[model samples]
Target: MLATPRPRSTFSNAQIAAYFYSPCRNQYDEPVPEYFRCRCWKIRKQTSRNGFTNLMQHVRSEHPTFQEEMLAATTAQTSSVAH
Candidate 1:
């Protein structure tokens, strides 16, 4: 059986931050508050205990391997900086 290809794990913190912080505007074109914004699956941020918990879950479920790689990369980067 053919295995599914994994997504690239090179997404930077800036990219993830951008996804979370991307403005959610209303029909009036005004920006909705972060708490009210739907981060994924058209589910509002308020649905989760924390504004980002559900969004992060979506990432974890949708891109499990990539997320693991991202965490490893982040840890390596941080350790390198401390040296």
Candidate 2:
């Protein structure tokens, strides 16, 4: 059986921030609020509370390796920075 190809880990912090911030306006030209532009918003809009809970539950299940890589990158960045 062919293994599923992993999603690329090439997304940068700026790209992740942009996804959460969604600096672009919506279709009606209304700006999307920062609070409503994130994965949280997507979860809220796309599913019920139970579904949202389930979705989060399986995040690492679905992408365990990616999550580990992201955590390592974040930890390295935090450690490298001086107060």
In the order shown, the candidates' Cα RMSDs to the true structure are 8.7, 9.8
In the range 19-65, model 1's lDDT, one tens digit per residue, is: 43355678998976653332443544534346555555655566555
Q: What is the clash count for each candidate, in the order shown? A: 0, 0
Candidate 2's TM-score: 0.27
lDDT of 2 by residue, 5-62 (tens): 9566444434333333233357898854432343444421223333334333334354
Q: For model 1, what is the C-alpha lDDT against the true structure?
A: 0.50
- Give the CA lDDT, 0 to 100, for residue 25 in model 1: 74
Q: Give the runs in model 1 whose Cα sits over 4 Å from its true position.
A: 1-15, 35-41, 46-51, 65-83
Cα lDDT listed for each candidate: 0.50, 0.41
* Candidate 2 Cα misplacement greater than 4 A, ranges: 1-26, 29-52, 75-83
